[model samples]
Target: MLQGEEASFFVLCDGKTALPLGTAQDHKRVGEGDTGPNTGGMGAYSPAPVLSEAVQERAMERIVRPTLREMSRRGMPFQGVLYAGLMIENGEPRLIEYNVRFGDPEAQVLMMRLGGQVLDLIQAAAEGRLDEVSVAWADDHALTVVLAARGYPGRVETGVPIRGTEGLPRSSVQMLFHAGTALQDGTLVAAGGRVLNATARGTTLQEARDRAYALVDAIDAPGLFCRRDIGWRALGPVQDAPATSQPT
Candidate 1:
């Protein structure tokens, strides 16, 4: 079988300019090591190493920019976030799909890295001021592990109470984003397939992975579980960490 890793690239557009924000990669399957059935996204990390600076430039030049030019040429100039899902092999990028909105788990990690500046970037892109603004990226990494209902990407138990969210770390380096949650009888409960995102940022990928997993272990959602090896592709395999979906 052909081998490659997928990378998610974000471009801010305003029908006049397209600006590349950065790259991220996400795990799509419901199980560990990228096995099992495909889901929206199980986890994600930003600043994918496989998409090096040189590779990103090539992708922009050969793929994204040309597509934008074509859209403009066809009198359908696009605005808003253009998320490109690209498969990288031998440092070359191949388009998998294009999403006009921010990706799910991918956006989770990217936002963890981008912080409040993302709002400014979006506003600038919407106002056609992309040329005047620039993304200020930190020299760090972010990873997010998605907590889904026990039987995700298929049938899932709904209305399952989710606890310990308030207890999870929330700071400049750690965060918890509720994706498929609802308030019922004054209780936070799982209302969809993917429920929560335990995200963290650190100086290195390993640190981010460790911190994210730390939140996963502390969540008291009996019906939710997450992959333990979220950054395995970038960080390589490890002997530690719990099994995927080990009951909380």
Candidate 2:
């Protein structure tokens, strides 16, 4: 097992050029100890401290650039968000895998931290004009907690009504993104395993985690649960170590 951080980078690639959009850490395990089966993502946080400035540079220089170059050389010319899942082993970033677009919970946190720059950057990349775009990230942290239905990552029980979604604290820092949700005759209910994402931004990782968890607490749903330790490692020492799982 790679006993390291689940660091990921969203790099906007436009054939001839590539630019990093942001970074995040996603929790994929279904259980608190990171034990149990892997799901899409139980929770996630942005600006993972494990992915230090030095590691970010190494990832771009060794992994992202080479991958893009190889893709272009093969005539594929990959464009869009090339999300690199990296494992920082012995202070050296190592490759894990790549996603074609923004990750679920990771996207929630990154978008929270980056604010409106996300859309502009994506549009620029799609138009192949990344050179003209620049990202302005707030020096803050964002966290997201996924509310999942019972038996998630397996045979989930759906159609459970969800409550407390109304009047969420909407502002520049807090928001909710709907995923596995639907309205049945004007009733909001869980449509899939992972139902809703509660995201919040704060000056520190702990504050962000606290805010996200508070949102999760406010939400009332049958068979809904989430990990309390979303960014435990990033905050400080791991009081409860969760098992590692694959990224969505």
Candidate 3:
């Protein structure tokens, strides 16, 4: 198993200039306590603690910028979201993988924390005008919990009836994003392994985590499971916190 925190950045590169839109961390395991086989992503939270301001600077200076420069040098000229899966050891950041696009649940949390003209930024990058675009990020924490069908990352049972989805918070700070779902006979049903994303934002990471999990618990879907400890590593050890969601 790969034991490292992920540092994801929404980069706006225009062949020469590479601008970062935001950073986030994704929980990729299928079980709590970080056990079980790897799924696409079980949950995610924005502004990972592992990627501090200094660490982000190092990543850009040593990793992202150079990569963009080399790509341009080779006439590739990449644009769009550049996700860097990183491994940090002894306070040093190392590259693990470079995803050309945004990771699944990672996009859910990042969109909640980012402000300004998002579409404009993306267009600017794609049009090679990234140097003219600036990003405005909110001083808030966001989290997302993925509700997966039974036997997910394996043989998932789909088409099951899902309930309690009619009434969930739908503000700029809290909402749900549908993933693998469909309507059958005019009824919403689970259509894939990862069905829904319960997402929320707050002033603190714990607040966001709590709000996201609350939504997860509210969904009365049978044969569906989600990791309760979505932001456990970022929240650290809480005194007598709910034991149902122990860190993996």
Candidate 4:
């Protein structure tokens, strides 16, 4: 056993991606480029525009519904949320795995998209009234980027001074949520593998991506690094776009 008592793991099937096309990637490390051993997820985001509603509906029919039925038949009676991690390999959706809980960075993005009534949705799920609850997504697309410690998933140097978080426009559709923050003598300090989630909601995925990167620029931390091309794979060509420019 890998002794994941303090951690959690999920099983992903290769064929799940083929049901109704969607692509997802896991944040396997506390740093960039899949380097180092896995941590509790430095961050994640999803609903790549390539994953159309038709595809997601197919996944619900072919994968999620059937899996739930099978689990119930086997007496498992799974009742919590399911994270179906997936990836597109050679234009085909492949199941990366299944997670029993919400993905970290992914959760932040989803929650931001879910907006004000998140508590209500959870309650409905718990009460088996999911049918009665309908998700009203904002017309805008959203993205979340994570900031982590330098040596995260390992021995990290904490308590570093962080700055440049004030004066953000309140109506700018951007939010900075604290994931691993601690107050030491009334000063906010980094405390975990992933520390802050900078999220933005916009009229489209490209717009959301633009806003997200803008928020990243406002932060002044040398130890922080975020994937500049978060939703690029799904949103389509932004290869040569400048980091500070807003997408149309």
Top of the candidates by lDDT? 1
Q: Give the lowest summed-lDDT range of ten residues in model 2.
A: 239-248
* RMSD of each predicted structure: 1.8, 3.8, 2.7, 7.6
Candidate 1 stretches greater than 4 Å from native = 240-248
lDDT of 3 by residue, 1-248 (tens): 55655566557677777887777888777877678889899999998888887887888888888888888889897777788878776557788888888789998898877743778888888888877878887789999999888888899888988888888888888889999999999888999989999999999998998888889888887767787778888876435544444322
Residue range 169-237, candidate 2, lDDT tens digits? 987778888999999989899999888999999998888888887787778775677776788666754
- Using lDDT as the yardstick, the better of models 1 and 2 is 1
lDDT score, candidate 2, position 200: 95
lDDT of 4 by residue, 92-157 (tens): 334556876667767666666766676776666666666655656556667777777666656776
Q: Give per-candidate clash totals.
A: 0, 4, 3, 4
- Candidate 1, residue 13: how far the Cα is off, in Å: 1.2
User: What is each predicted model's overall lDDT from 0 to 1?
Assistant: 0.88, 0.82, 0.81, 0.58
TM-score of 2: 0.91
**Candidate 2 stretches greater than 4 Å from native:** 1-3, 236-248
Quote the lDDT for 77 in model 3: 77
Q: Which of 1 and 2 is ahead in TM-score?
A: 1
Per-candidate TM vs. native? 0.94, 0.91, 0.91, 0.74
Model 4: colliding residue pairs? 12-97, 17-93, 24-86, 44-105
Q: What is the lDDT of residue 198 in candidate 1?
A: 91
